[model samples]
Target: MTPWTTLLVPDILRRICEYQRGIYEDVVPFRRFLSNGATVHGTSKQAQAFESVLSPWLALYPSISRLVASYEPIKHALACHCAYTGRAGILQHLHKRYILQSVAVNLCQMAIAGQRLDVLEYLVCIGYELPRQFESVYLSWKDQAVFDFVFEHYRPLCTTNTTIYAFASSGNEDALMRLLSYVDEAQIRLMWSVAASHGHVELARTIYTASVDISDHVYQFAGSSFFSTTFQHIKNAANVGSIDGMFWIYDIANPFFSQEDRIAVVGFCLKYAVMENLWDRVWTLLEQADGRVDYPQLLACLPYFKWPQDESNARSMLSSTPALIPMFCTSWLPTIKDQAKRRLLEEELMSMAVLYHDGDRLEAREWLGDVDEYYFNAMEWLMDEYCIDKSIAHDVFQGPLGVAAMKRAIENDHIATMRLLLKYGVQIVPEYIFRRGGIRAIKFYLDKVNPEFTIPVDLLVEMASTPTNDTVFQIVHRTWRARTSITIVHTVESQCIAQAEAHGQVNIIIYLAKSFQSVHSPSEYETFLIQHVQDFYCAFNRARHGVNQLFAIWNPVLDACFNVEFILESLDSLLALTEENLKRLVSLSFVHIPTELIVQCALTNSVLAWRVFCILLDAKIKDKSSRMELQRECLVKKYEGRKFRNVPTVDGLGF
Candidate 1:
């Protein structure tokens, strides 16, 4: 009917040959929406609107290609919007071919409105000068949104003060570049001043090099955020000529920088110190401050900086040295309300450091510095916070202390404190207090510290036989015997059995073996037998029906820790397996497998299983792969050792 309508609608409807529309919104006629394009490569119902406009003109050109070049951009833009923006039934007569600038401006609008960059980049290559907003798209979404808000609100092309200042305040170098193209020289100058005032030196440098009058145009807004940020930007500019420009700003507004801004200025000056490393210029700043910069930074490198005081050289000189870190230690002890209390706290800390500075074991162990309280207080001070703060003595000191305090606690037989401390890095070197208290406790850290901090094993053994305070050396003999290299297993065995008989501390053997493992691998059967032997002996050592709850509880803890897998591979484990499980060992050997299967098949007795596991582990440590795989397979198969012989079946036995 109209020139914009196409006859293809009739052809497509004829091909459909059916009308199917449903009452439900869920169902709609499909033929009306289907594309009937067959010969056309890129044209479809999606482009039907543009095609309708083209249909009337088609007889004049007689070929689609003749008119395609002029209409491509509009089609692509519409297609992109329809596909991505979820808009439908757009106008069909969009012109495709476009001048670069028009397309670029259109793309710039799209980019600022949050369109994807890939689509914008396509527009750029096809002849768009590519607006800076597209580049700022690479930044974070918040930055892009902020820039968009400035551009949308300001209307920069009209050259208003609000628009110019908004762009300057936005801190978007890309958006500022776009603004420069449309705005007047005076507007740009105001922008430069605002940027400089805001510490955006980099942005100012970009604008100045792009041929705007740097000095002449920007001076009208001399006292704004632009002024300050501009000077810093110019100073940071890579070109040597920009340096002179930055200094010129400094001459006019030297005191304009705020106190915090001055710190930034100081930092910038320090950054340039490599040029004049002799420290002559820096010394002047320090003298002006009377050597006290008062920045609260402990490592502030300016030594001459001090609180304005006359001739405190001796104190000031050493303050530059790092040993003065102790001067800050008073700041370390937890919290105090009054500044006067803080001074008192620092005094106490300096005195504490002195008391512990020498090799006083007790003082070293009783480390008074409350690191936890200090940490929490530092965190609180940062947040300008308070937490109904606990008393310094009760919250910090009265509670179990840190790692260093644990040593003193153990030395003093402070059991609960020692356990809490053991959870951390603080170690217990057995040589110090192995005789007096739980001797295994010394072995706790000894095994870990053993390789690096070597302790004499001979001394440990000797101490067991002859110790200070007439205390027996519990760990020395047991530890030395479990080692692969010690070979002195019998001596410790005899000593342990005798001690267990004499003092009835039979469980000491198992505890000793556990301690010994940290020093060396348990290689010997007899050495591993320690736990089993202790277990066997403990049953007799018990009074009657049930074990003492104290010992029973300790037994389960040991049981949970004892590795049954290792025990299953040992000779002892082999003897203890079910008779049938042991018979399967022969079959496994025929299949070129290990006999450990038989040992592992046995029902696990808590003590026996653990001890054997340790022995077998020592054997397995030498080979990790093939054996490990087989062990895994055995576990997966649940192949406990073989069953007993079935009435001497010769056929099954392969007789």
Candidate 2:
């Protein structure tokens, strides 16, 4: 084989290995094929290829061992693939080729991981010893048959309680029963711990029945159990809303748990119960606690209550605890007839909303219905209480609560809240609306504004600086034209063109230029037009430099900063003018045309090169050195067209 083809052999093998291992998610074999009615790690075709193709092919050469020795990871990976895919033929071939003493353990581990009893047997047949104290191997199999095979033939020693725990947790009853005969009392309790934590109640009952001298009370098992297994099962069950499992474990393990453990368990259960909207469970747990709880701790849990799912239930829950109603719950606010209590709930709800900027939470309670004024009162309370503690002040708000809320709505992209705020006559800073609210918010605001109100020309120009909805510019121009003169319109379009050029908004410049062309003759705005085109050429040069600095990162920020070739193609309509028009514009501006632009223009379209490069010469923008280089490059191009006489020199040409 050629050297290049030979060098690619390892990489090719690795890719094949990856394919067998299902590393490529988009590949056909991995997604479509299944093994034993489950998603396959390796397809049958992969196994056949390993056995029929790769194994026999490698066997023909003694250099196969050298290749395996050179790339050790690939060798191990190949071995793993063989064991995992149950390709015993290739595995035997690999053993015959390269069986290093150190690699035997890894091969055995992979065999066990393969969950194939035959592969394990083959490794032993090849004189490889299985590791002593095989807890990991025991933990590996969820299949009962594999465990049974290991027990019948191999029976590797067990050192820790981990094997039984894994068996119990995996719900392998047959494996756990077989394992129960071997372990002592400590390991037996550990098995019970796993069963209790995982809610394997029948398995726990089986262990209690099978084991001798075990008490009916679970505290006997709990004392020697893992600490996390003891206390955490309660929280785990509570978190998953497994009330039966939680209470069963609680009733069993109650004697062993400390006061702190009980508090943590109750707190965690109460919090999730509230969030899960388990009202019956919440009331029952609260009644069982019977004022043993810290009121402040329970009050803290009230804020997280799932108010949206059952608002009436939440109201009743809050009303049952009247003091917390004044603190956290907002559902009761709509029903509270007392003015003082209504104000208190309103202040608390809005304070939480403003502090968290949680629009969904605030919206859930319908607190914004007639409470427009209360939003500011809430902001004040936040400033005095919450903000003051953090050394923050009222300056966080732009103006009134409604305007602040409107800004928050814009930031969070909450359109409904924005409309509601606007409907309530919340005045907003027009620039902030244009900048942050984007086109949709701008349209909403414009639709709500009085007919006489037009967005300020300066703000419109600012918006035009970046790419925004073209419809906004059209609307502003259409509205502003009726009140203003053609001269003022020309000036507005000119400033917009300048802003668009400065920010490299090629499309916007084209749009504004087309709009300007419709209104007036080109000659009337010749100076302004020339300056705008010059600014574009300069901006393009900066964009090229900016692109070199920030490589491979693409986003809107990058587009705004470093828009390149697409800008050239997009601006063709505005820039592809006649030669004389281009020359006159370039000459009037007095800025140097970039030589790179000339070269790119030549390459992009040779016809447009004449129009663009002629301006470079006529404007005296091409310096003597650049002129010589361009001439020399042209001479070389010209000479290369035929049998060359001699290589051209810059000095040979007349200066």
Whose lDDT is greatest here? 2
| Model 1 residue 323 distance off true place after TM-score fit, in angstroms | 7.4
The C-alpha TM-scores of every prediction are: 0.25, 0.37
lDDT of all the models against the reference?
0.40, 0.53
Stretch of 10 with least lDDT, candidate 2: 548-557
All candidates: CA RMSD in angstroms?
A: 24.5, 23.6
How do the residues 1-655 of candidate 2 rate in per-residue lDDT, one tens digit apiece?
Answer: 4433433465554444344433222222222222223222343235444443345334434444544544444455456557765768767777776673434345565566557678877877777776654446333667666666667656644325556667766667777677777777667766655675577767776775677544443334444344456666666556555555566666555556565665555655676567656678777666555324555666667566553456556545443332343344333344457766645545444444443334343222223333423433443444344332211222232245546577766554455656545544656677776677655556666666545566678877887786666676666556666656656777787787778768766556656655665666656535444545454554444352332111211211222333233233322431444454444434433334555555544344455664554455445434767776675565565455567467546576442
The residue-level lDDT of candidate 1 at 500 comes to: 42
Worst 10 residues of 1 by lDDT: 20-29
> Model 2 off-target regions past 4 Å?
1-194, 197-339, 357-400, 411-413, 464-483, 502-505, 518-655
